[model samples]
Each structure stands twice: as structure tokens, then as C-alpha cells.
Target: MKNVTSLASGAVTALVLSLGLAGGAAAEDFEWPRLLVIGTPGTSSGSFASTNGWGPILQKETGTTVRIVPEDSETQRYRRLTDREDIAISSVSASEMRYQIQGIDGYSQTKPVAQRILWHHNDTPWGYVVAGDSPVKSVQDIKNGGVRITQGVFSPPMVSAVTVGLPAMLGMSEDEVAEKIEFVPASSYAENCRSVVEGKSDIAYCSPISSVLSEMEGAPGSIRWLDLDPSDKEGWNAYLAERPMLIPAEIEMGVKTARGVNGATSNFVYSVPATADVDFAYNMAKWFHESFDAYKGTHPLATRMSMDQFRKYLNRTPLPVHEGTVKYLREIGQWSDEDDTWNNKAIETMDAWIAARQEALKAAQEQGIEVNFENQEFLDLMKEKTAGVENFQSRL
Candidate 1:
């Protein structure tokens, strides 16, 4: 990936630099859409990097004004893009995508942001780091030692991806694991890294793919990632069984820090919600595929973009592919009978989850619990009860 001139121009196209639409792919131009509003993670994130670069290019290519709106969190961005009343598109973290689709974890109380997959880019490992000077070098050390870990309290990617996955992998519950490590919750990754450097936290849950974490590694206090026990099949099974978005990752030279051989998480995903019109999504995706090569060199992560990664993760089952994406896949001969089967299964799985969501809501109301889940209490309750979520798992 090329060096970004601005914070908004990071490698996420690399993922930020990484690149994405649909009607079975587009045959012609889309009409009726005067403006295409794009939602992305805040100003300095990888998603923002892509937005910052792509907006201008898209405008130049299509002769349309690209309004890139920034949201503080992935959830906020997803909410805006998925809102029927809003005219916008969003790029989201795949980690959060899993939770939002399942209506579990941090999204338990929120409405499902189950939109179509149009574009994909950026695949980074997910995990945490300890001070390079610290003695902790493995998951077991952090799990068994009196290590203090910090993460975003309400952030789904942090909470579900690391905050909770770490404990599950250790064969303990969150409360039980709390006895060994002090859990420090922060509002942002910058704060998490600051806490780590100041000795307030022994570890900060992160990945090298993040510019912030990469910067943290270069700060006064350097850090190293904890290696998971790759041979621990039970542990790996338990952790991944809950969160399927992550695949095994061995990150050596990352966005900032370098890693040794380790059992980290990786996947080729960086996606935007394709909820726009079929023709629009198709044409949009088509243009992106064509323009992708022009921007991949703008950021480190952008340089990681490839057609192979796109084919592998773009159409992962249970995450519906937009018509526009389908068209592109077909045009490239990437679509196959196997994909058709999976896509059908994905539709079935989604139906089950959507059905379960309603069932869960109705059950909550019958027990005097309002279905309106805007607070922590309701979200927690929904996760704990599992009411209708169980049904969907069987379908999956």
C-alpha cells in the first residue's frame, strides 16, 4: 500500500485502500439516484481512508457528487445506511457484520443491519497486544496472569472479537477470567493504546491492520502480540464456533508492527452494504472493480487487494450477495454451481434469523419486556435468553 497523505487515506482501501455491487452485475447506467451518499467509519479509520480516496475518483469517473459521511462507530454507520428513511451506503467491519446479522453480542438489542454485500476489501488478523517489554507473550499468560487488558467498552468488534473471544478461548467465562486479568474498558482504540503504554493496561485488544494500533506500536512503549496455542483444537473450536468471521492469520509485516508466527485471526473481508437499487449497485460495483487497480497502491492495505480474496470472501454463505455483485461474479466466471447452492442456503439462513428476531421480540414483550432495545439492559437480556436465536443456529 502507498503512504496516505491524510488520515482518511489509509490502507483499508488497502482495506481503506481496499475495494467493491449488482443486478446479476450491470448491463447499463442507473437512473433516479441523484446522489449516492456513502457512510464510512470516522475520519481517521481504514474505511475513511477508502472513502477519502474513492469519493473523488468515483465523482470523476461517474460525474456524480460523492458525499462521504463519517460516523463515530461501525454500528452507527450501519444504522444510518440500513435505515429505510436514509439515502446512504456504508462500509462496515466484517467482525461487526457477523454480530449485527445475528442480533447477538453488542447488537443484541438493535435492529438487524442485514444488507447486501456489494464490495469487499481489507482482511486483517484480529487479536490483542502486550507491551514489548512485558513478560506476557501468549494467551495463556494473559489468561492466567494478573494482566490488565483494555478495549472499547461498547465497541462490538472489540467486545465480541477480543474482549469475549479471548476468555472463551481460555476455557473460562468472562466473569471467571476477570479474576485473573483486570478488564479496562475504554471508549476508543487511542485510549486503549494510551492505557497500555501508561501501564494502566498490560494489553490492548487490537490488530496490526489498524493504523491506530500500528501507531501505538511505534510510540514510546512498543508492543508484541500474544500467540494463540495453534495446537489447542478445543480452544480454537470453542472460540471460532461463536464467531465465524475470523479465519486463521499469520501476520508478519502488518500495517505497522511486525509479528512472528502466531495463531491470530484473519479473513479477506472489507465490505460495504449494497442496499441501493439493483441497477445502481451493479453499475457501482462494476466501476469499482474497474477502478480498483488505480487506487490499490495508495495505501499498504490497499495493495493487498486481489481478485482471489474478493472471490473467497465476497460471497461467504449466510451473507446475501447483492444482485450487482452476482453480475460481476458471473462476468468474471467467478460464480459457480457451488456458489448458487450456498447462496440459496444463505437465503434460508437469513430467513431463519429474521424470523427468530421477531420471535424473540414477541417473547420479550409477553414477559413485560418491551421489544424496543436501545439500552444495555435489553441487549444483555436478549443475548442471555437466546429465545429465538437457537432456532437459527440449527438452520445454519
Candidate 2:
């Protein structure tokens, strides 16, 4: 990756130096939409708030009326983008794409959506959190048994983190982790953290920016995030075994509650379907890069949307990047040969999974079995059949 100014320092400098850049910028040859819609998580979500913060700036700068839609369900948002293509782009995580592509878990009956990545916007550095008064100080302390870990019932990403990702981080199997930790059900992401505050669950995974953390911090029990020593290569290796998309970037400017903890971050991007117009993707990326000075202060997370941070995590995304965005990245000398190799491999893997989903659906029909995530027989059949395909495993 090319060396560039960090967002923390560069954002403020750009604000002072290039205050007039967006206003005086020349119009591009590519056409701009009068109205642009961006799909994101519910209004209560940080991602949604982030868009709301910067959406207006984008609209004012580009003369596009940016409309933001909030959907609480990731699968619903994924379906909207893939099946309907009503929204210009939908904010999604790498792990969510992994499940959607494989048609696993909540995506059991659905076909793999053909979405391509646009850019790495910002990263959320989060970890398993506990009440300040709880006995758990580090991740190691959770293995003592009798501890309750919040298992998000509605959110598959949260469920995967607690059930699979967290355990792998500790070098333990899901079965082994289950034996030690009591899994408490949580209805949503907010409820997961609220459970910790309410004392219904001892621990829950969360980020400092989450609005619920204030409640957790002010609660009688207080809030404490379990440490995951960054220098421990063995521990991280195990964690990446299950979640390769997660980055160990430090949370230097995180909320007061997150200070002095190991920083493990996951980048969320605004992705579009493969069939999206090439010029649309190209312009969206180019606009964000050029208008950094105008939108950096619109939201705290918006500052991280700079080209520097985008390139830092560009090579880490597991999804197939859109060709239009690739054109921009290549023009800027950010896309390397290694990136092309990784991107091609990811595209091949995605195509294989899409084909496997079709085969799985056909086999289920022939066997007179209902296709459902809850149906263990159908799940097993999918696993058995797709096991031979190259890069067939789910990253979540």
C-alpha cells in the first residue's frame, strides 16, 4: 500500500487547506443522478447515522438528492440490493457477504446475490464487553464457566461472532465454548448490549461508538471490554481462522470506555450489485475522495471515509471489487498486482458458491426436503456437496 497521511491528522489539515475545493471543483463528464438512495441499517444504527451525517453534504456538492433508507435486517437489505436494485448501494460487512454468497444460515432459501464492493468507508473496532464489576477481566477469564455470553438471535453476524468467531480467537471449538459459557438469547444488537447492562447477560460484543454503551457505562455495574492482547500471534491466528475479514486496527480515538483494549476492527462498505452502472460506481468513489474536506466533519466516522483509509483496507476486503471502482483505484496507483490476484480469486470463489447454491436447491427438491436454515438435513447436504469446491468454506 502507498504511504499517505492518516485520516486523524489529514482530515483537519484538508479542512483548512481545501475548504473551497468542493465548491470550485469542475463537473465530471459522467452523469449525476438527481436522486440517489443509500440503504443502511436501522435509524438506531451507527451506520445509518453516519450516512445521514454525510448524505446531505454529498447531495449539496454533487447536486444529487441523497435519500437514506434504514432496514434493520441485513438479509432484507441484501435482498433489496440484489433482487430489486432499487437502492444505488447498500452498506454491508464482509462477513455478511460471505453468508449471502454461500446461502447459509438466514440466507438458506435465497440465491447468492451478485454484489461487488465499491470502497472501504470506515471500520468499527469492537470486542466482547462485560459489566465493570464482572469477574471477567480478559477473554481467558470467560473460560472459567458460569459466564453468560449474549447470543444475538436476530442478527446472524452477532451470532457468528459469539458462537464461532470468539471461540476461534481463544483456540476453542464452538462446542467447547458452549460447555464453558452460558449462551443467553438477545433479540438485536442493542438488546445484546442492554442485556449486559440489565444483568441478564454477563458479556456481549460491541463497539465504543454504540449508543447503548453510554447506558452500560452509566449503569451501576459499569462497562468493561474483555482484553484480546494484540501481540499474541497464536490467539489472532485462531481468530482469523474463522474471521479473516476482521482487521486488528487500533481504536485510538474511540470512546473513553474503549481505551487500553486490544483493537480488532471490521470494515463496512457501501456495495452495489454486479449489474450496477460502471460510471455510477466510479463517480461515487471519485466524489468521496475529492470532497473529503466538505464531509469530514459531518460525522465522526465520516472523517475515516478519506482515500487514505480506503486504500489502507482496500486489499483486505474479501468481496469482488466493482470494475469501475477498480478503474479509479488503479488510476490513483492504489490497486496493485496482489490486489488483482486476490480479487480474481474472490470472484471465482463467489461464482463457485452461487453454482453450489443452485445445486443444493436442486438436490433438496429431488429429495423432497424443505429448504430451511433450521433443517439440519438440508444444511448437512449443502456442506457435504459443496465440500469439494475450491474455497467453499463460509468466512463467518
Full-model lDDT for every candidate = 0.62, 0.74
Q: For candidate 1, report its TM-score.
A: 0.68
Question: Which candidate comes out best when scored by TM-score?
Answer: 2
Q: How good is model 2 by TM-score?
A: 0.74
lDDT of 2 by residue, 44-122 (tens): 8778988898899888877767778888899888876777555667888776776777776889788666678887767
Q: Given candidate 1, what's the lDDT at residue 156?
A: 67
Candidate 2 regions off by >4 Å? 1-27, 129-167, 172-204, 215-225, 231-233, 240-245, 362-381, 390-396
lDDT of 1 by residue, 1-396 (tens): 211011122343311211122233335534324445676677887766856776777787777666676777766655655543243466666556666777855466666545666766566665667777887867777657687888677676566656667778888876777678677888876787667767888877666666677666787767777776656767766776666656555565464454664645444343444444556656666776777887777666664455666665644434667766777778788888878787666666666665666666666778777655576556655665454443222111
Candidate 1: where is the Cα deviation over 4 Å? 1-34, 71-80, 104-114, 121-125, 131-137, 140-164, 172-203, 209-222, 229-233, 241-244, 252-277, 298-305, 312-318, 359-370, 374-396
Clashes of 1: 31
Clashing pairs in 2: none
For model 2, give the 10-residue run with minimal summed lDDT: 1-10
Shift in Å, residue 151, candidate 2: 6.2
- In model 1, the Cα lDDT at residue 170 comes to 85
TM-score of each: 0.68, 0.74
